[model samples]
Target: MAKQEAKFDLYVFHRSYFCGKMMAYMRYKQIPCNTIYATLDKHGSDIASNTGLRQMPCVRTPEEQWLQDTTPMMDWFEERFPQAPVVPTDPVVGFLTRLLEDYADEWMWRPSIYYRWHTKEDRTLYKKLFVDELLGGFWAIGGPVSWLAGKLVHRHQEEKFLSGDGLTKANRKHVEAVYINTLDRLETIFQKQPYLLGSHPSLADFGFFGSMFWHFSNDPTSNRIMQERAPGVYEWVARLWNATSTKLGEVKFDYVVGQVPEGWEPLLRDACEAYLPYLSENAQHFEKGSKRFDWNVQGFLYPGVHVSPYRVWCRERLQGFLNALSESDQNRVREILEPMGGWKPLTSNAHIQSNWDPEGIAPLCKPQKLPLMYKLKSRFTGSNHVRTRRAWMKD
Candidate 1:
């Protein structure tokens, strides 16, 4: 008997950064896969039915199993096709890459979605492009729900983003700042090397790129910030998806810290303040000391929040990512990430299960009864601060 050819297909939204993430990996690995454009109409529902989730960037496998979410889907691919590895051979670096990717995927997505869906001007531009650039091909096949479908999907995401509490102006400001700060840091970080992981691109690069490349870079307000604030970083972001490159000057790599130019600090600091709650929530999750916690137990608001041991552990996880590389790479990551001190010493000693099935990421595998919510609190402890010494080895 002859072996059956593998059937690989992606149901995606062209403007979606996660979709782009999957596409980048597919292209990099040279994986043979079919592409299907999913919109907000019946067809979109059809795609969602196949995936058992409304969120996109889903994959239909050779055996016709629908896999949703980027991480699990990517893990599936890594397991199936181990030849062209997206992860580094060094354990620490690989772990860091995954951690950063998670942060990038979850933290940064709010701003990209908000800017695209909320801001009137951005929404207009995006809608026009969706019907023309994104759905042009699908339209040829009589897919008329491009704009409506997109709006429906955007509305769904909006509900989720605004679900926990009504998205306030302060929330918008903070979310926007997340992108700017991330880009500022990314600009400096990438200046030290060609990719986030030194010589080669890792999941972190794509993770950041997922939002940065399509959403921010494409938007006028955010793009101006990226360009004027950190041109090199902005340019480098484009380079991740091969969207931008140098043609004349000799390429160089020299690491530097706190190198953000004048006039950018206020933007970055504002963003930092906005990000505190989200970071705080991450910390609080671990502090709850529950072996397993819902990914969204805490609301990403800008008010009083609690620190969890989980945040510290994750911070250490970031350091672990750096430790994967050679001494030089470790130095590079430390220099770039240390100044922030988001993951410093912790005051609490809490026991949390480290296993994926038993702890932090376990919710992703099982069903949940209710959505997680967090109310503002008056006091918080340093327990959420994770020191560098407590880092774990990526399994």
Candidate 2:
């Protein structure tokens, strides 16, 4: 068979979390993809016209098909182009990979955004790039207009991410500790192996890689911390980027079939302990039809954070993965999770079906454009909510 070319046009800002994740994934797969900056002024209308919301990392395929949401997009890619598969065939391994991916996708987002906006050095540089993405297409580039746009964007991020989500002077140190713990765990894993799974960069690696490669490794403050503390993890970022699917055949994928890598236990522990409970809380709020709810992860409270219908969908997906397992595999997986206090949240609610997107159309869908006047329901809308509030009609 000829080497297939899957050329895709990607709309993304260089510093975006999911954008970097998708880019890294494409590079590893050796897919023909081009990165097009999805700046607010230039591609804002294009994004609004194409996908569910004004979000970055939207994909336009060679066939002119539009895709949003990395989780489903990657799964679609794995099915459409099965060359050098990243998802393992072993049922246990595959299930664990999806669980880890879901955790990385939904949970790590808070700390990832926090590092970019909360830390002074990272914020100083990132704020300017952010303003340009939002207002650069306008007539005046840098004076008073730029200043105001920056102010609004910065304040919105600080509120929505830093304060709104939950950051108290009391729990601030604890939040930083969560990020550091991840770095230390990943650093240890990288020190032992080339990737999170085995020889190949599995879904687990790509899931974490989106935030690690984009925000932590590149931003000034977090980058410095990663360099000083987790050098191995920093190096793995580049290693995974440099790897290609065709080249990975050189390494043998030797495993005991069902055993999760010992090195991955800490990451799984964190996901079970931290990520699952957070999902359960969000699911409760969505079930109650409440607009906002308290977030108490590991006993640290982030009260009154807005409820997310999207995350309820995420929790539902995780539950599906668990339920799809074979009876024996489920029992073994339960043994691993129950000790870590992970199993309850996944099974506590007998029925967890989020009616957010009932038609099963995601990544590929008919356009459903919301009125430009309406605020985007997704939290990671690049602060488009604030931008629309003031600069609704373009800067």
Weakest ten-residue segment in model 1 by summed lDDT: 375-384
Candidate 1 residue lDDT tens string, 270-304 = 32333333454455565565333333312444332
Clashing pairs for predicted structure model 2, backbone only:
none
Residues 1-395 of candidate 2: C-alpha lDDT, one tens digit per residue: 99877689988877878888888888877778888876766776677666646677888888777887788889878887778777777777777788888888777788888888887777887777787764456522788876766666778788887788777876777778877998999998889888877688888888888889888899888898899999998999999888898888743444556777667788888988888887787788777878788777776888778777777788877777778889998888888788888889877774766765565666674455566454332222344442221111100
Which regions of candidate 2 deviate over 4 angstroms?
1-6, 250-254, 375-395
TM-score of 1: 0.61
**Among all candidates shown, the one with the greatest TM-score:** 2
| Per-residue lDDT of 280 in model 2 | 84
Kindly report which residue stretches of model 1 are placed more than 4 angstroms away from their true locations once superposed.
1-7, 40-42, 127-159, 162-166, 243-395
- Error at 212, model 2, angstroms: 1.0
